[model samples]
Target: MENTNTLTEYLTERQKFVNDEITNLIKQMDAPLQLKDSMLYSMEAGGKRLRPILMMASCESYGGNYKSVMTIAVALEMIHTYSLIHDDLPAMDDDNFRRGKPTNHRKFDEATAILAGDGLLTHSFTVISEDNQLTSDQKVFLIQELANASGPTGMVAGQILDIEGEKVETSLEDLEEIHLLKTGQLIKFAIVSGAYIGGASTHQLESINDFAYYLGLIFQVQDDILDVSGDQELMGKPVGSDENNFKSTYPKLLGLEGAIEQKEKYVQKAKEALKSAGIKNSLLEELTDYLSNRDY
Candidate 1:
């Protein structure tokens, strides 16, 4: 049966569950107090918790028990949080604030922040490997796939390209490549891993994977759009930072209208791919619309 809950209500309930799990995970860690604090600072700093939610939604779409993938979902969120911690460091984006709070580097020492990111990144794999719910093969598949998605050929590669592209003009194709890897890989992992664990047929997995790819692009495109037009208070950050940084964005490459059109195209393709996977009237379909239309 389709989820009857509105997206708002669904996100609230799922976010609370994810947050509780994250807090418990941190409490169980044997890390130093400072390190744990630093890690938790960013972890608790509110955002949409989109990655974990996506994994949960994908699994549910395939009739799998959401609890079965809960550990993986939390691990995925840890990875995302770690990336944000580093991305805010002076050596990187040098962002001082995130989610309206001082960034990890600002709240804690840079060294501690770096170590916190490292701790989160490395420990994510540990949680997955140690999870009692998954099979050995499932663990192997997830660990390898996560490494591939977040490592050199995936998000990191995309990040470096984004940094390099900032110094020079970037074509629309180049921009797409940058975002697809930097932002899309983990998103792909969230959906693919969840669907795989949820017992999707191979053919269905292929279609769902395609849907995830487009959704990732849609996410980035909307991010670019929000950078230009979103409310600063709601976003918990200043608008126009992208412009100030002179970074290549969808809006910069293609006027605001063009970027919106591009986002619409991605949304349409995402829906088609979801339908192809034989998933209909599910939370995934609602999320496709919600993500693109989100203000923050």
Candidate 2:
């Protein structure tokens, strides 16, 4: 990886690149002005941009140019944004705010928000298909992987489980399963797919896959932790919304101390997986630590 820049600097530079690319891609889409506006609204609404950054970082960790996976990275971000848009709909989480702004459904009409999410999700595949950097086989593999992660079997299944779990008490095991699918699957795709495109060996892929799973759990645990004890202004949304929704969370299931302990366990496991993959002292490791302790 590039050793000259700190992680903060690297993130800022890469985020700008990803944002510019997303804008360019949206401009090329021959869609209605309203639809495009809704899509851009959520896309430009700021978050960590963690998924695309992880994909790019993973590729570079294996000695591949970040540009080699840039299109796929953007596609992953689009899918993530789509999920957030739909998740905030009235029929779903009924969230009014996201990233400190009115959600898509609130900014526009519910129907238009739904279409914007649909446009982004479907158009992501088109973006990948048009990438000149990847071979036909690579494109096919990535598309299948992304579909399996975000489609009915992966994130969708987890969403249903989360909804159901809200009505009843949930076990630790059950909660892990829900998050592993809901949050972890896409995270797994971001890292593993990037590494594969960067020319990882089969053995390395196996180890990194393990790392991704633990990292995903860490992310959800921290999210749950933040819901219990985070600043609304910093997070750009109200905390304790989980309790309001009666959703089961790490802090709820395991207590605050237990949740912190759980995050640490996952952090250690993630580092172990990285060491086993022969990937050490890299951006992936740094990002893992950051996720464990993030306040928002």
Candidate 3:
């Protein structure tokens, strides 16, 4: 019971921290007239803020301060939200719903949505690049990390693979390859970027990277399961989406029980990585467990 109480408090506190930063970043944007409303529409929609939270969690886990990484973390979420907005556009996923409400294109016009997504994408780099404390070397790394994770060789490649996989029968290996890039890259960036910006030691970065790598894959596995089992009211999107779209998933590749087993294995791997670091981050450990078991 005490353990449960501790985990609950950690989650609530972390949520508060990221939630505040997200609001501030959106409010302070110097957006153009044509794109402002649509950009704000999705930015303020209140998704999980998982990436930014992971940045803080991982930074703190490595004995680094979370506050120092807040702006960069917010920048990560903005880039992620921008991708989702564009992915929902007619030319992409054509998703009409997000967070149980109208997507950007649904709330605003298509051109506006396009420009808004574009604005967010461009501005994400600007925010990180313009930060005064980040040395040119650090800023360069941040830009590279953000671009590679969200760009052609990373998430975009994964997305393209997903789109291509639709045209033909897919193998389990194919699905893993797609998601490793598609979802995992950005997540990996979130976990490690915090350490990079915090000036973590080389060994610390390696350990943190290992923890995040498995955490990221397991995170996606849980999502595939949630999209199958989660309530639309709770998930803010329809359930059984992977099945609905005929998209192959971990649950499909390895049965539901098998996928759970895989997720646990990765979670264990993540925990073990932290163990070698000889750190006591009860919050970070519990967060890994939460990601392993989360329903949405």
TM-score of each: 0.98, 0.98, 0.92
lDDT of 1 by residue, 171-249 (tens): 9999989999999999999999989898899899899989999999999999999999999999999999999986899
Candidate rank order under lDDT:
1, 2, 3
Encode model 2's per-residue lDDT on 35-145: one tens digit a residue.
999998899998788999999888877877888888899899999999999999999999999989999999999999999999999988999999998899989999999
Give the C-alpha miss distance for residue 51 in model 1, angstroms.
Answer: 0.5
- Compared with the true structure, model 2 gives a TM-score of 0.98
Worst 10 residues of 1 by lDDT: 1-10
Instruction: List candidate 2 stretches off by more than 4 Å.
Output: 1-4
lDDT of each: 0.92, 0.91, 0.81
lDDT of 3 by residue, 1-296 (tens): 12336766766776778778777777777767557777777877887778887887777766778787888887888788888988888887888998888999888889888888888888889889878877899889889989999999998899889888877778877887888888888888997897776667788778877887788788889998887677678788888867867678888888888888988888888889878754536666877888888876
Q: After aligning candidate 2 to the native by TM-score, how far in Å is the CA of 57 from where it should be?
A: 1.0
Whose lDDT is higher: candidate 1's or candidate 3's? 1
